[model samples]
Target: LHTGCIPPIVHRDIKTTNILLDQNFQAKLADFGLSRSFPTGNETHVSTVVAGTPGYLDPEYYRTNWLTEKSDIYSFGIVLLEIITNQPIIQQSREKPHIVEWVSFMIRKGDIRNIMDPNLHQNYDIGSVWKATEIAMSCVSPSSIGRPNMSRVANDLKECLISENSRTGESRDMESKSMEFSMGIYTEVIPKAR
Candidate 1:
């Protein structure tokens, strides 16, 4: 579900609505209106017109008009944050700030629990939630260079899922063994004459 080009391509506009989901809940990226192709070579950045959803736009691109693969990465990071927090990118709470701002503040304060959606309480694993949150924050970092590429993000997510699955399996196996032992089903064999 990823495409790479020489010098790489700039998505320009990556947003939630543009990401279509099928009946089976498969994600398909759509709407490439602002997309532009860049030639592959030794170039740090390319200047282009401002084009993209408001909340998902990269500040750096807006300021310098310089586009790069990292612009898409910044947008994708916002999407990931939305997925984890189940909160819209923008909120109209006078007392609270935007989702990104709020998340950044909480992260800076090292208070991840404060940002988690209360609805997920007791339903999701704490470790996995924190790990996902960390990755999302890293993706949206102010410094584009600090952000990971799409491939790395996907790989990290996959690894986290796999680790959680393995932990669940191990827990189940341990429980089953404990039950068998409690039922006296396992017998300790004593060696006979050599």
Candidate 2:
């Protein structure tokens, strides 16, 4: 169903712990106590009292009290960072810095790999990791307008995963071709697109 309608549904609270994984490891978002719906064209952003977890809370919402769909995006970005780095949203270092600040610092230093989970080792593709990290950073940008919409974030992740899969497939094919060529089997070169 390609319903174009985007009814104003506010999640209000979004965090990594609030997300549950099924038997198949599919994510299901939960805990919507602060969720609400506003009629379209009436008022998208509301000047409500500050609510939601501290680390995941939108700075814009905290400053202006204007709650919109982007608030959820900010929270989701923190959740994404948690998933990637396997680190808590708030961790106590020598000086306590939120996950967003930590990530931003690493990104500023041009060493995003430092923030990746050591447990994954070399199993994960670096390109995919970088792409996801970029999306997370965009989501957590200080300006609400700088962050992408939820739908856009979802689409970008999907595309990154797809591209990674395609690259893996291509590498396998090239390796197979190289082995065959070495074994005295003639391999035909595919014509490149103009």
lDDT of 1: 0.72
State the RMSD for candidate 2: 10.9
lDDT of each: 0.72, 0.75
Q: Give a tens-digit lDDT track for model 2, residues 1-194.
A: 00133666778889877888888566677987887665678565877888899889999999999988889899999989998888888888714378888888887787767788878775667777787898899999998889987667765665566667686664343233212222232334322211
Candidate 1 segments whose C-alpha is farther than 4 A from its true place? 1-3, 94-96, 167-194
For candidate 2, give the lDDT.
0.75
TM-score result, candidate 1: 0.78
Residues 1-194, candidate 1, lDDT per residue (tens digit)? 22445545777888888889888565778987778887666777887788898989988888888887888889999998888777889888723556778788877787766677767674555677677777787788777889877767765564456556675663343333212222222333322211
Per-candidate TM-scores read 0.78, 0.79
